[model samples]
Target: MSGIVFAIPGDIDAPTGGYGYDRRLLREWHEAGIEARHIALPGSFPFPTEADLATTERLLAATAPDDVLLVDGLAFGAFPEALAARFADRLVALVHHPLAMETGLKPEAADTLRRSERLALARARTIVASSPTTRATLETEFGVPASEIVVAAPGCDPAPRASGSRGGAPLRLLAVGSLIPRKGYGDLVEAAAAIADRAWTLTIAGSPDHAPETAAQLRSVIARDGLADRIVLAGAVGPDKLAQLYDEADLFVMPSLYEGYGMVLTEALARGLPIVTTLSGAGAEALPDAAALKVPPGDAAALAKALARLIDAPAERRQRADAAWAAAGDLPRWSETARIVAEACLRDRASARNAARGFREKPMQDQRAREQD
Candidate 1:
């Protein structure tokens, strides 16, 4: 293979799960001696401006002919079919989740994305999904063949066991993710309000920049429900601060409407923190029953009930925490994720070469047949 060019649309170092996964994969490949490099595309993805799209096209077109271009789905799924076709043979789509499945899209916009993603995914040499939920969605909903997709779940880094609050002063609940509608921050705030009788403080550590309106709305609701004192939106934090936050957390909560794979859940497990999460997309299977209390997505009442259950019972929380720690050992590592993606890239390269060889030989074989005739 000439090289593997990882094309990502926004800041690769962004604290979001998708970017974190992409960053880790590239880092692992570099450490493992695999020849790979990053190509920064326009940040306005999933809805790029015309100028950004043109710039993206130029950046992609500059890749070496034989380089396997693994494009992140945020931009790839929104590319016009004509542009997608230009690099179809070398393109590999890295789909965290279908863009159309995002929580707050208008029907027409969803339809457009669904159609565009279907076309883009179909054209790519291979599709790499972050979870089986995503892979199945591509196969059934997006009309991509199962054989063309690879599921490379995000890896969890090992961490020290969180020293949860002792003697039960108050529960320390932590929810991490960008303040986007799809993360269900509103639902989480509502749920937290319902359980105000419980002695607990919730800290949501994520970027507010991803959705300023959602962040504002969350703040309004937190104040409206008289939870302003109990809830803290810590915005984004660096890795050290995040790790420290994780260390002090008593419980990990994720109320996302959907996740291709909940990397934070595994991170919680790595630190032996009990979990409360929604059964949305991969979140349903991201953690074992013993490690989490799961309720349906968007169900604030059910979420509040689950939160209460874990809050009132310290023994139960410890049991779940222990289970989480036990499960952590089985979580995929960054190295393994990199290995699977590297294998996929290599396989696509080989397949492309074989297809090109067949294309070259076909005309010669036809000419020979004509001469014999």
Candidate 2:
């Protein structure tokens, strides 16, 4: 059998979460014996100019009907309605969440993007969401029928062995995600402030993508709370550096208000770090039991309490981290995700052919009735 082709318009050169997910899926597709090729669309998407649209048009025109086009949610936002109408029957959209509707977007922009997202979902033959949370949002907020949507949870790479000094010194806390309001970085800073008396250091890694004002706000908070020395802002570390941080840290916290899927949580669990996160994001699902410390979104007090409890009790932290690590091992690999996609594509194609044949037969039967009349 001919192999299936998967196309995505994302920055293949970048090492961000979305980029990593796409790369893993491609690797899995190849492992599953499906021929997959990824096309990196221009980095400027979701607000692509006319020239960018022309480039994308050329790329889409080059794709054959037999190929399975997997459009990334980021680029799919700007995907013209004409383009969607043209390929509605053959395309599958991989939504990581409604990017344009993120809290980071300006109010006007968010509204426009929300509309675009709904239209895209309506036109897509298959819509694959990375989390059940996001799937529910698509159905409730965007009006995507449950029958057309499938939940394909993101997979994690194998967890790294925990390597660090098992000491009585201050615990190290890590939070990873872009520095943005939606990520609840401000709340994290406040949590850090509340627990400054404890012998702990908080390291935040990731550049700000939205709410540039929040950076100044965080600086002010750090100064006022006298936590400038203890709270370190380590911006945009590479995977190797992140792995090192994970190994050195005792706990991981991501207090985001929302996420399509929290890949960072999976990475933290793989490194055997106990997690503290909010229930609003997709990563909340990653913690099946008490393995993670859960808190309400935007509640600095609750987050502070959760962090303090983990810091004060070394035994509990280690116990939870071990359980989290064990659970992480069971997460599906990229190869499994690829296999599912391929199977779904094959089934959809077969169903389409059957429907077409039935349609053709219907017209013939109608003509015979007219002749009898």
Candidate 3:
């Protein structure tokens, strides 16, 4: 059997969550004996530009008709109808989260994007979401039938790192994600401020892409809260550096306002780090009950309380960390995720071929004429 080919528009350079998911998916597909390729699209603001469209067109023209085109949510959300029409027969869209529903966008812009997403999803041969929350939203918000959508949760790297020595004085806390409003970093900074007198240091690591204003606001908050000395912004570190940080950290916090599926949470869990997060999206669903400390989104006081609890109770923290490590062991590997995706793509392709053959064998108009006769 010929292998599946995925045409993803996720940028390879940046450290975005979607890019991480795509990277892992591709790795998994290859391990599962599925031939998968990612076509990088040009970077554009808000949506894919004319250049991106042209690049996608070129890729489509070159690809075999039977090859599965796995479109990422970013590109699908950006140019829904056109992509759907162009690759209607062999297209499967992977939605991490609904970009149109993010709170940061203007009402009119959000509405336009949402409309485009609906149209694009409708045109897909199959739609795979990263979380059940996303699947439900697709059915409820976009009116997509439940039967057409499948939920394939994101996977984490399984390798364990050697334990690093904890430095003296301050307890180390790490938060990793793009420095944006949705990440709730500003709120975390505020929470950090509330406990500034405590001996704890925070490292915020991620590349900034969207909402420069939010990044600016977070910086301002950090300075104003007198956390300048305690907080550090380590922008866009490589995987090795990130693994080192995770190994060294005493705690991990991701107070995201929303997520499709939180791959970072899984990564942190894999490192055996106790976590603090909000109940925002499907990503939060990955949290093991005993391993995580939950707080309401945008609530600095609650976050502060959670942080304080973790800091003050050393024995409990260690226990939670141990539990987190054990829970991480249960997460699906990239190879497993790839196998499921490859199987789904193969099934969709076979279904499309059968439908096409049926259409050719019995013309609808001819059947209607025979009924009349």
Candidate 4:
């Protein structure tokens, strides 16, 4: 068992969902006695500098030939076709989401990513998608064969139900995600402002460093709407703090434009918090309808209406929370996710070995037949 070499860009411990998934996957693989190692590539992925590209080539080329190379799509999707082709026989691509579908990209950049990712994915021996929706997109949009993709959704850890607010306290709304344009935090602020007449406060727990301009815009919106006191931006919270936020929250809201898989939705459901989320990307199907008041992404009015419904009728919120709590038992575990990837790696290595063995044996067989003749 030569094991797997997981190549990922940037800090593996970053608070975002993709980084969190990678960290937990590696941890679970190690716990399961699978020989898995991490290789940190340059953080400027999906758009690496020439020097960085050379460095990436050197780092990946250094891995043992027998080792399975599992590359995260953040960098893998952007690799030159020549680079991707080099490891085609042993490469496994972990695509969180296609880079081109990210919100706020210019048309030219999007097209470039789409072309590059299609080429890169075609060279992978196996492709691991974070959700079924992502798998479908890759198959239909990227022209990947259905057999090459595997869906390994993120797992959830069970937690105690939230205590919520006291009788006299305002409703506590919590939203967790990174402050990137794709998250649609600006729309969240707009919706929050729409329901200012109600007694509620929103706390958004996410790192603002990913997109400082988006963070600045959100701040401007908050000040412009005079919601400085009602909305709190708790940036980059630790796990303990996030758990506390979940515990104290009466409702969870996510207005993401898209998600490869909505890991935070599972986190909120694990805590039995009623949700108000948009139906965008995989997040739309992450939870059953009863668990959240769903709305179209970027529609502030509809989002505001849904928020008001849950706020005005606490019993409905309680009902939704009950549904979320019931569903938590069925959510996938981290161990399961790790198991799927490990199996994929082993299967790929076996296939490669067999192909090589057959190639070697074919010539010998031919030579023996000729001698017999």
The number of the candidate with the highest TM-score is: 4
Residue 131 in model 4: lDDT: 91
Query: Model 4, range 144-258, lDDT digits (tens) per residue?
Result: 9999998888877657788999889999999999899999988889998988999999999999998899999999999999999999999999999998999999999989888
Ranking, lDDT, top scorer first: 4, 1, 3, 2
Q: Please estimate how well model 3 matches the true structure, expressed as its whole-model Cα lDDT.
A: 0.77
Flag clash pairs in model 1.
none
The RMSD of every model to the true structure, in order and in angstroms, is 11.0, 11.6, 11.0, 10.9
Q: Which pairs, if any, clash in model 3?
A: 262-283
Residue-level lDDT of model 3, residues 262-356, one tens digit each, is: 88888888778888888777667658879889888889899999998998888988888999878765666554455556656765566435323
Q: For each predicted model, how many residue pairs clash, with residues at least 3 apart or on different chains?
A: 0, 0, 1, 0
- Comparing 1 with 4 on TM-score, the higher-scoring candidate is 4
**TM-score of every candidate relative to the true structure:** 0.92, 0.86, 0.88, 0.92
**Reference-based lDDT, each prediction:** 0.86, 0.75, 0.77, 0.87
Q: RMSD (Cα, Å) of candidate 1?
A: 11.0
Candidate 3 vs candidate 4: which has greater TM-score? 4
| Residues 3-113 of candidate 1: C-alpha lDDT, one tens digit per residue | 789999989989988999999988877766677899999999899999999999999999899888999999999999989999988888999999999988999999999
| Candidate 2 regions with alpha-carbon error over 4 angstroms | 1-7, 165-168, 209-220, 346-373
Stretches off by above 4 angstroms in model 4 are 348-373
